[model samples]
Target: MTESDLTSNFPQQSGLPGEKRTDELGMRILKAAQTMFVRDGVDAVSMHKVAKTVGIGQGTLYRRYPNKGSLCMSLMQTKFDCFAEAINEYLRDAANATVFERLSRVVSSLIRFSENDLDWLKAILQSGTLKDAKANIFESPPFLFIRDTVQRLLEEAAAKRELVPLDPAFASVLITSSMTPELMFYLFDSGYTPERIAERYVETFLAPLFAGAGRI
Candidate 1:
């Protein structure tokens, strides 16, 4: 199916009181599913189990989310929104900081988010919604947000003579692509902590770009 077809398949409730209740129930479903997934692992949690946890009927839950992947996408969307807001706030607060420092903080924030939501992210990737989409994940909002942020930072650094002359657009893609959930999960399985991964990622992938800038 086309990307638009996939997106449009998801339910979109309207109206006031009904919409409010639907939103509340949706939040409850997400919370219950997240708790179960984090505690029992995604493979161990069933939709029936999630419905039971949320005190909703299986049919009710199914109406909202046809499958676990759909539910996971909703959960990931919630987390991504908050993460994006936090990154925006951080950037605003650190506007005067060196470009490298801002980039480091943003990248580290992203790593922390990935580590925290690992299971949900894994389920989303495997769900086929993204895999089957015509545009794929590179065109997804979350990826675009990070890529644009990184690209803007790189451009700022270049303007300040803090970064080496390079194509910010391609460089941003290189940096953001490296932080995919698949690679992060591999690193985690390889016994690397999020902090360690973030550190090494900054040092290896980002440091050379701003080598002469000197860390503040």
Candidate 2:
């Protein structure tokens, strides 16, 4: 199926009481799966293992997520949504300032989030990087969601004359590629202060992006 068709199938529902319950259950299942995948490998973590970790029967896991692909897709989507919500919330509540101020706040929040989820993210990123892997996890809805969000903001910034007129797609890739938590983990493994990494990140990537654009 096409991307639009695929996206149409994953509806967002959470406000209703029933949806809230499902949301809670989904989160529990996702966390269990994440733990298992991190401790073991993605291929090693089965629906049965996730069910066992969540203290539920295999039937329940199957009922919720019929297959491995579906489970992984849902798990990534849920986790990414939650992560993005946190950043969006921080941006919304930030003190009155320019959009640049809000972006700075969100970027710092992202750094903190990466540090908070470092272990699991590190493991997953390393394992998921294998070229032989069957599933292209990065091509899933979750990644697309984040990419789109970043792209939208880039487009908005350009339209408002806060940033130069560049292709939103390339800007999205640049932002995400530069700030990816896994990159920071790699940098640390190679020996660099996270503080320095973050500082240079803004100075190098972000500062240049805005330099050529007119301010709103």
Candidate 3:
């Protein structure tokens, strides 16, 4: 996505009460933080260093992003927005594709997104941001977008009687849970490449669920 798209997707209420900053400044901070994080690793970078790099006061940076977790979350949000848009665009353009094909691609996309943003995700988790009600990630916009998309596709397959009768809602929740950062990290630690994980996920989960249709 473009810089504007990232900036547009930035959370307005990311900081403490009454925390406010211009979009331009927010984008600048995000860019600076991301650069430092990518160059030095999230664990090595400090909020003070980020402010120094951005030529902003530490207090100003703190007001906009109370912690590294909040900053990482904002960065992840931008990536999530791009991920959501890519899936939507693919679905729209793949109107001729079978529900099975579309679903597989969507699942693959989600896997890739998780793998690509693993660093930021890990940082966010370690930062204790996930404990916040406002950052309850499962209910976040981008995650919900993908989860609903997956459910809708499952519902479509069910409607056509192409799959075994199943509860799409529960199935979607299960499938999305598999792709979470924590699970993905475990799979990675277990020596699973992203490609292998996607393939195995489809085979172990989707193939059986969709067995009735011979989509596998």
Candidate 4:
């Protein structure tokens, strides 16, 4: 689906015209929930505390989300539009690059995602409560946010012999393997700059993968 579709479907709390009609009270509840979910784990946040935080009653919180998982899901959905835009922007910016350049940037995008959007991602990955929400095996992953864009590139890569012929999904996963911030986190905790790791990543893995890859 287009980013416009994601935007239209998952209405934000930041005053979209048709998104929810946010009165001051609803906005307060939303803001409070964002703070709570980011600050505390989803399981730890409660309806009562949400009510207290927004100066509303438990009845009011229920008016928004029937339960905590749904409430937090709503919070995540709210953030999806902005995240989609950022990813699409990066993909567009890399559009004119060579296949290898695009793949490198997509890997870079994954690492940036892990570092920038850690808390919301942690909530989604850790919480299975939202699994029934029209889910996919990969939807909950922040990487899957850009899955279509990356997957199509993989398909073309295999078609053109850019890399060894592989399943698009597997190739995409292979390209992203161990390029996470968790890997970077280890590097950082053990003291390595993001730049050094990225340079090493390209030389060690990416260059060989696409040495003479061309359009199919």
Tell how far residue 54 is off in model 1, in angstroms.
3.5
| Candidate 4 ranges beyond 4 A from true positions | 1-28, 35-47, 62-70, 123-135, 139-144, 159-161, 173-208, 212-216
Q: Model 2 off-target regions past 4 Å?
A: 1-77, 94-96, 126-138, 213-216
Question: Rank order by lDDT, top first?
Answer: 1, 3, 2, 4
Question: What are the runs in model 3 whose C-alpha is more than 4 Å off?
Answer: 1-21, 134-136
Per-candidate TM-scores read 0.82, 0.59, 0.86, 0.60
Please give the ranking of all candidate structures by TM-score, highest first, separated by commas: 3, 1, 4, 2
How does model 1 fare in lDDT? 0.83
Candidate 1, residues 35-80: lDDT per residue as tens digits?
7876798989999999999998999999988788888888677667
Q: Candidate 2 residues 98-191, lDDT tens each?
A: 6655665556656655665555454455544333433654575545665676786677677778886679888776676566555767877787
**Which candidate should be chosen as best, given TM-score against the real structure?**
3
RMSD of each: 6.6, 8.3, 4.0, 6.4
- Residue 14, model 2: Cα distance from true site in angstroms: 11
Task: List the lowest-lDDT window of 10 residues for candidate 3.
Answer: 12-21
Give the number of the best model, judged by lDDT: 1
Distance from true position, residue 151, model 4, in Å?
Answer: 1.4
C-alpha local distance difference test of each model: 0.83, 0.64, 0.82, 0.63
Candidate 4: the clashing residue pairs are none
TM-score of 2: 0.59
